[model samples]
Each structure stands twice: as C-alpha cells, then as structure tokens.
Target: MRKTVSLFAMLTALLVLLAACGGNQTGGSAGSSGAAGGGEKKTIKFGATAGPYSDMVTKAIKPLLEKKGYKVELVEFNDYVQPNKALANGSIDANLFQHILYLKQFATDNKLDIQEVISVPTAPMGLYSNKFKTLDSIENGSLLTIANDPSNLARSLLMLQSMGLITVKKDVNAATLSEKDIVDNPKSLQFKPVEAASLPRTLDSTALAVVPGNFALAAGMDLTKALKLEEMAENYRNVIAIKTADKDSQFAKDLKEAVQSDEFEKTIDEQFKGFSKPQWMTGK
Candidate 1:
C-alpha cells in the first residue's frame, strides 16, 4: 500500500516536469509563456536611406515584419555610402537603399562583403530642363550637364544614349564612363559631368540637365516634364540587399516576405505613383 502511494507521487512529479519542459520549448503553455505568447521574441535589424524610402520601411514593412514574429529595428542613414559599409561591418542585417547597379558598384569599388540579392524598385532618371521647353528646341551645339559621380554619370549618360543624344563605347564599362567614352556624338552636344544635385541648378546654364527621379520629385518636376526616360516601369527590379554570407537563411525569407507583402506593395503604388510601382516586388 505504501509502495503504491509513492509510485503515484512519483508519476505526478514526472508529469509536472514534462509540462514545464514543454512550456519552455514551445512558449505556448496553458497560461501562455515562452519565446512567443507573452514571451520574448526575436528581432531583425535593417537600414534605410533618408527620404521616402525610409518612411516606407518604418510605416509599412516594419509592422508587417512584427506581425510575423520579428521585432524589426530600422536604422536610418542620410548618405548612401554608410548603409553598404554598415552592412559589410555586420552593423545591419539588410539594407534597402540601392538598385542593382548601385549595389554592384558599391560592392566592387569598396570591396565590401555584399551582393545584389534582389531588386525592389527602379527609378528611371530623366532629362529635366526649365529653359528649353522641348528636346527639339535645344540647339545641337548646346551643352548638357550630367552627374559627375561615377554612379549617376553612367545612369545619366545611358538615358542620353537611349535618347540618341550620344553613344557610349560598346566595350566601356557603364559605371566608370567619361567624355572619352562617348563614341558617337553627331549632335555636337557638349557633355558636362557636374555633381548630381548641381545638375538641376544648372538647368539655365546648360541646355539640358539629366536628373534622377528622386531629385526631380524633390525639385517639384513631374515625369511629364522630362524630355526622355527609361522604358522600365517605375518600380522595376531596384533591390533589397543582404550580406553575401546571409543569402541562405530563414531571416532572408522573412525580409523578403515583409518587403513584398501585398500591403507594402499598395503603399508603393499609392505613394510612388510615377516614381515607383509594385510589378518588381517578387523573388523567393
């Protein structure tokens, strides 16, 4: 009789131990507690460039990520260089500030530990001018100002090449182009590689100015005002990038899902109507 009573007590203690272990592992016990229900959850760190892009991450993406069981902490940077550097140094898990071209150049030029993981949105820069009402109005010998920065220079010149203003050598690298790179210039248009921000200010000084869509929007010029543009839809494969080592992980999956959420895509459509679209919000 005494032996039976001791066995009953032992069994009850074992059952209690099993229940406690389950609670610790599952974080979903009867009363609710663990790493989830009313318990501490994991976190994800991300960085964004200053401007509307940062706002999108905070207001749209962050909340969606939180819903999927991640505490998203986003850091904002005013300059372009820091985000990639930050990612390289392990300061950030991912960055959403650059397109594939920008990422490629940044990774190559700095030899940073990064890669172009995926494209988020494409910003088709345009040739904006307040002086000349139309492209045809600009004289052939007229001078045009493009961005001097290597990254913007390539994009600006590419737009010009597409519009038949000039032609870059087929063999030349797109990111490190210069005046000598112009293989064909039948129009006799002078090319000036001025600072990107100065391009708009030089509208009167130069016959034409190649301005990025972001700066154009900041300058209050509509897409209709541009003399020429890339056929790429606004939100074409820009990119959301992660470190080279993190390409294969569940964290990458969460980041992808949060950025490509239907809710986030709607914000892209409404907020960046001409500046971006959601057709490129895809990938595994």
Candidate 2:
C-alpha cells in the first residue's frame, strides 16, 4: 500500500512540475511580447539609402523612438529604387531618402501610393571638375556628365542653367527638364548622361560632372572646391515618406515627430556637419 502511495505521489509531483513549466513558458512569452515596464511596444521598420540618411537615423531617430518604448528597425538600401519598393510592398513601414520631387515622380511612375510625411534637410547638388579649375576653363565641345535619373537630371540641368552654361526653354518645368529642353548651349558643352551614383566616378574622365550632395560626400569631394552648388530649394529637401494609407497612423506620426525634434536637429548638425542644410532653418 505504501509503495502504491509512493508511486501515486511521484505521478502527482510530475504532473505539478509539468504544469508549472507550462505556466512559466506562457508567462515568458507574454513578457517577451510586452516592453520592460509591461506595455506592448510597436516596431517601426524604416528604410533609407546607405549614407547620410542611415547615419542620421542611427545617430538620432533610433534612440528617440526607443526611449518612447518603440523599436526601430532601419533597413538600408544601396540604390534609390529599392527603398520605395520595400515600403510599397509592406516590407518596411517608412522611408527617408528622396526629396519631395523624387518621391512624387517615383510614386507616379511606379503607381505606388507613397507620400511624404515631413521634409528633413537639403543636400544641395554640386558641379565638380577634376580637369578644369574654373567654369571659364571649360572649352566648347568639352564633355560634361550629369545624372540620368529624371529628377536629378533636371536638377543638374537647372544648375547648369543657373551658372549661365546653358539656357533651358522658357516655361519648361525645371523638375522635368532634359537635354532636349536646352535651347542654347553657349559652350556647345557635350552632355553625357550617367547613373547618378556613377557621376562621381566620371570626374576623372569628364570635363565637369554635376553630383548630388550625398553622392559628392560619399566620394569625399570637397564642397568648397565645387565649381558651383545648387541652392537649397523647398522641392529639393529630402523627406520622410510612408504609404498614403498610413498618413494618419501613430507610427507615422511618431516618426515625423522624432525627426522634427530638437534632438534630431542637433544630431543632423553634428552628423552632417553643415554639409546638408536643415530645411527648418530655411523655413522650407
């Protein structure tokens, strides 16, 4: 009778232990899902190109969001194309890289419903030359390179026009202008359209190359040495973007607020080192 009782006790203990283990697992999972202080935290997956955009997010925005019990996952892309693709497919929650103009053009052309949340800063486009010391030194028929992408190509052309190197057709929209829009090329400057990312690489071969600020920074080109730099304009300021459906979402609001925060502005000043001018300062 005692042996049978002992066996029964052993079975009871085993059952109790199993129940305790199961209970612990359930609690663990619940705790895991909750933040340290016991509330659910939302994770925002933000996409950006791999340079200043990612740097700013890492240095500023990520910490700001995390302090508010949010998790920020930064997805870095090498090219301008994939960040929007990721956002549209729901692979990411938002993106911060392109300007209002680029974002609008990309969304319209790709039939994506992405929209801007807030403007960040302007990385002004610059014209740089390794061969020529001054614009006057550039001879007629000399080869010049510019970004082939629609928005940047137009920006590059406008920069050239501003320098009196070329004249674009009157009433032609600066955002969509092309080589064909050039009504007069006083220098007879031959234009070579290359990938925006490749314009820096072409500096050695081309007489002059107009490079976006981000690309110029990446190539270690001194902005002070640029023959000409495009002035920061409202349309050219980079912005955070999200799906149109998420325009009013809490995540979107949090992101916009975080970037617009004073802390983020300080970070931008520190990280970009005045290379990119904050749009807020310009009131744009």
Predicted structure with the largest TM-score when compared to the true one: 2
Q: What's the residue-level lDDT of 85 in candidate 2?
A: 90
Candidate 1 lDDT over residue span 177-213, tens digit each: 7777888888798877777766667886777888876
Residue 131 in candidate 2 has what lDDT? 83
TM-score per prediction, in order, is: 0.75, 0.76
- Give me candidate 2's TM-score against the actual structure: 0.76
Evaluated at residue 262, the lDDT of candidate 1 is 81
Task: Tell me how far the alpha carbon of residue 132 in candidate 2 is from the true structure, in angstroms, after superposition.
Answer: 4.0
lDDT of 2: 0.80
Q: What tens-digit string does per-residue lDDT give for candidate 2 at 1-284?
A: 99999999999999999999976543222212212233232677889888778887788789988877677788899888999998898888878898888899899999999999888865689888888888888888989999998878988888888889999999998667899999999889999999988889998888889999898878877776888788767888888898898787666677778877888778877666545565575453
